[model samples]
Target: MQLTNHDAANPSYWQARWREGRTGWDLGGVHPLFSELMQEAHAAGLKPNARVIEPGCGRAHTGAALAKMNYIVTAFDVSKEAVDAAKVLYANETKLELVVADLFALPSNWSNSFDAVYDRAVLCALPQASRPSYVHACAKILKTGGLFLSIPFTKLHISASEGPPFAVDEANLESLFEADFEKVCHIEKQHSVKDSKIACEMLIVWRKK
Candidate 1:
């Protein structure tokens, strides 16, 4: 599979998927790994009211969960349809701010604005070449010494010709974050996904330096 900007693996392609309700990637709700990570963060002394942002926050389940826990949660997605769905899903929660905005083109008013950023199915969703800019944007929006928690899909079967859920090995993941973050904890774990076990989901928690 040739990984290229012209491939069906770009952001516009994902936007179209959401428009057509073809988002197999939409898990309908929060992933269990996220819940476990939040539990760990709480145990590690993160306060309830921390400012949190979720980029590419499709359906914003993580935002909803954080809001319920009293965090000031903000979430954004480039696809307006996805944002609309998230709003409907999280309507009763006043603690979260859901906006339709491109991750790379975030509003100028938001620099250094968040205490922590949580991402799942966001970074790895992008085409491989676009990841560096995505990482840079995440770093820019995060406050100095803030936290970044990511659950990225790794070791997925994909040819260069196919993907929206792109694969990331340990080396690729490290190359994406090591320059911008102070690595804190990295875990490679198996996750139960419906009828099968996904053996290569990696969880990374980083403290912005």
Candidate 2:
């Protein structure tokens, strides 16, 4: 399972991982944290039928779950294989639309079109240098006062050069999005991943300013 490239920012790196069937990150279903987060969002006035988007939606299990919960979901991935597979897996979910699109270059028509963005590890999957751009893109697609829900790994021992999931802590998150988003909530929960180096995941909800 040795990959020649460790470049997380490149789509080809992820495409190759899928081609090799090396996606250990796929949870096979919606993440355990999603239901509770949805509840929190709902309590915060995020209603059903809201336009929700998931960036780097691998397999789109969460996206499908959102669709099942009656939200309009648009999930996109850089890898065509990932998007195609997700589309097939959730074929019956009419409210869920999966597309292959670069997160940094999303369609112009999508600007300020989303009510919320679900970023499950998408930020950690990217190189650290790309975090600013990643946050900018997410903020760009969201309407004013829209939500940004993120579940990022914390206390990861590995460096960016070692590979993702990269270490992203509360400070790291605030540094990137504080300019455009206001922190609404931050909850720390045990990670589903088995790695010891990953202490936990921080579920941060930010409202666009």
Candidate 3:
């Protein structure tokens, strides 16, 4: 996926975007791939009782969707405005909690406590240096044998420096999750980048093993 808005490493940049209504990642509705996977996860017995976290949830559409489907969800974003919007959208959903906090600084009680971690754009959105922390955090928040659903943008033609949605590939994922998680499967689709270039889009699932 191409990131139209690339924010700085600082949180204030994103806060400004949210405050100014510059979010391009909020798809307004749940992404079809994520919606299908949520249903598939329910069929796999992770249903009304399962706990999930959506890190860096932009407008929290996916988390809200999951809450509607009976999954307990905690969606966090550094942007207070984003969280405020989400709260307004999900006022009646008791199954979801929206938090305004940095993903790296989540409370200790949350560690290793979730049945699943839904990493939408958070992984690739981070600067390269933060990826290890991100992977560790994802693994930490998920219980053993839990699942991690990652949808990261793969850099095919774009330079690594030209991104908030940084270029990533299987090697990046393996280097991050290989020790504590196993790649169960992955699907890649070519995405159109700027000026007719192509990017490798990946939907990967990892099971903590």
Candidate with best lDDT: 2
Task: For candidate 2, write residues 96-185 as lDDT tens digits.
Answer: 999999997999999999999998878888878888999999999999989998778876766656667787888888899899999888
- Model 3 over residues 102-166: C-alpha lDDT tens digits? 87788899988998888877787787787888888888888998888866777546566655667
The candidate that achieves the highest TM-score relative to the unseen native structure: 2
Q: Give the alpha-carbon lDDT of every model.
A: 0.79, 0.87, 0.77
Point out the worst 10-residue segment of candidate 1 by lDDT. Answer: 1-10
For model 2, what is the alpha-carbon lDDT of residue 59?
A: 95
Instruction: Name model 3 segments beyond 4 Å from true.
Output: 1-7, 39-45, 192-198
Candidate 2 stretches with Cα past 4 Å from truth are 1-6
